[model samples]
Target: MTRFQSKVALVTGGRSGIGRAIAKRLREEGARVITAQRGQDTEFECIGVDFNEPEAADDAIATVMQLAGRLDVLVNNAGMMQEQLAEEMSLVDWTRNLTVNLTTPFALIKASLPHLRQTQGRIVNIGSTEGLGSNPKHAAYCASKAGLHGLTRAIAIDHSHEGIRCNAVAPGWIDTDLNIDFIESMPDPKAFKQGLGKIHPVGRTGTPEEVANLVAWLASEESGFVTGQVWTVDGGRMAKLSLPG
Candidate 1:
């Protein structure tokens, strides 16, 4: 049988990048996927809601439940990153990053909890390598992702008896549009990409499909015993402190 046969999944920020890949993979695995994004209409059934808005999380969950009848898996893959030093970062910038990256996932999980409990589902939160270790000019992003890691553990402990699993995936540098744009905007795009690739023990960046595959396994019965874990999918970037140093 297909891993996701008869399963229902909701993917936040499913318009592009990793979220999009997860949604597509879940659907291909026989899931009924409802993707939610801000103002983007996807090929699959999707809802338009800016997660930054007050009512967006609730509305997105309601829309998914209405269409799918139940929520079997929730992928909290929506996040934002701002490049600014601590001294230069404003309260608004800090709050924006937290609200979108951390708070939004909390809200979505809260809203989807009853349904998840009913179905005994799982949650796959997309974190970052930054959450594991600090980097320059990423204070707010790191804090938010770290908080998400904490939240994942809390949820696992609180709901394990109820058969709900919660986990996180901390991806290293992937070649997504965000990274592509960032590199293109640099003076030497090729060097920028090459430098990031060399830092990884695998000697290359990761792909969205690779992350999606891990998520699919976690969301399936294959990973039923796993919970409260933060799996890094960063081409072994987090494995060694210094690569070939």
Candidate 2:
């Protein structure tokens, strides 16, 4: 049998990028996948949820429970990032980043905890390398992701005895629509990509599939003992530092 055979997974922001890749991967591994996004789509059992809204987490959880009766895995993959230095960022931008990145995930996990505990399920939080270290023009993004790391650990510590495992996957410089759009908006798109690519020891950006694979494993029985850990899949980006000239 497949690793995730007979499992039910609810993935947030599953319409695109890493979330979409994770949803597809879960389905391929024999899980009945349900997706929640701001827009509807026929590709899967999609539930519309404006994650920016306060009630969206509860609404999405209700939809998932109505469809599957139980949630065996919750992938909190929905998040937003703003590019602004600490000095330039406004309260609105900072609040929005935290709301989307940190608050929403916490709400989703809380809403799903009962069902997850019943099934001995897992929570896989999609974090970022920025959570672990500094980045230019990303104060809000970094802070929010770092907060997620703390939240993930808290969940693991509080619920591990109940058979619910919580872990985080921090990806680095993934090549996704978000990144592509940012690059395309630049004056020299090719140069932007190349310059960004060079920072990674692997000489390339990580793929959504690679991140998805790690998440899948963490959510499955293969990682049954793992909890409260932050796994980094960054192409060695966080391991190297630039030397002084």
Candidate 3:
């Protein structure tokens, strides 16, 4: 369980939901975790900053290097999804989605390359099933996550020789706080949840802990040979094709 005894990890948006689970899992496995978030306080070593600002990426890396000295894992888990029709989504909304979901990870990767190269560290990007497919009123989210998927592959190929491994974890309908809130707000929460589970072959949605477990393996040496891959931890949702009932 102490696979990361000597490792230092940076998890963006680690204050809540999927990112929080990732940070907790890494810490449980004996890694010294540093969480970066906007206006949220975490029990772990945290850096409060807005990743939406382009410069925050470099600043966050600098802070991590200063605090931990060596970085072994960079989990780009912070992201936001705004729901709007393609035609209704404004330039600002589109830009915001891409900035947080795609560009922030790019900036972090660029800034961490030197340190990661030194440590032969790994990068685990928290992508989404939306990237692989599409959803109603999710144009911006899908586009940004698709960009993130491409970025993961590019980084894996570009830095493989340097001992850097980049992979993405694409999750679908995880039962996170954000998701729960949205589901509860629906007119028929029970029916909504049941419908979601029915669509997935596993008969249920996934959890943050499940996704974190996959991330831990990918970040650790156990998955040393894996790179440039999009691993879906979606309870087989992506593999199933629905038929008329």
Candidate 4:
């Protein structure tokens, strides 16, 4: 599917997990892929960046423009999840979550606007199902992702005339190393893992590639009319009513 042939894409945090999957999908669809991640070793053209820094977003965009010559798709995929209750969540953690999950994507979009405008490119933000609803002890994460979805809509509205489309994908309980690490860190990893599938109506958690495929479609011209939307790929989890155990 050479839908992205002759295109260039920059994916944030493309070294592993969901971001990595998205990058691979874009590449397989024929886009030249550039990745901004913390590590130096990567198969894709890499930019070493720490999203915690305020300048990281702009710096990444600049690097991509210099190396790749142009940007056709921007995937704001790097994010942090701080699982803390509102009562126990520190100011530092709250601010960090917003910075990484919300502010960084905004900065990247702003920096890449000119180039994307030239190419009529697209932006796919990796939001979470938690943004649409809530979970126990995920106050900071939910708030930040909610802000990210808002940012997605604003960009879509503001840039549609410029030929840039912005949309977000909200994933639920994706089976990734990061998610596995989170589950393993739990007090009862086995029970948590065992029970995770039943929550989704599909009877299984989503895979990174599943989310990646949706992102690829959204990034392509096939979804040209889809913008300012938050698409949830949650294995039917969002459709089910929450019932007491």
- How well is each residue in 131-240 modelled by candidate 4, as lDDT tens digits? 99998898988988999999999999999988999999999989899788989999999888778888888888889999999999999999999999999999999999
Q: What C-alpha lDDT values do all the predictions have?
A: 0.91, 0.92, 0.94, 0.92
Task: Please give each candidate's TM-score.
Answer: 0.95, 0.94, 0.98, 0.95
Highest lDDT: which candidate?
Answer: 3
Q: Candidate 3: RMSD over Cα atoms?
A: 0.9
lDDT of 2 by residue, 1-245 (tens): 37899899999888899998999999999999998888886778998888889999999998888988999999999888788888898998899999999999999999999899899999999998899997789899999999999999999999999999999999988878888898899999999888887888888888999999999999999998899999999999889897664
lDDT of 3 by residue, 29-50 (tens): 9999999988856498999888
- Per-candidate RMSD vs. true structure? 1.6, 1.6, 0.9, 1.5
For candidate 3, what is the TM-score? 0.98
Pick by TM-score: 3 or 4, better one = 3
lDDT of 1 by residue, 1-245 (tens): 38999999999888899998999999999998888888765477888888879888998899888887899999999899998999999999899999999999999999999999999999999998899998888999999999999999999999978989999999988878887898899999899888887888888998999999999999999998999999999888778677365
Candidate 4, overall lDDT?
Answer: 0.92
The best candidate by TM-score is: 3
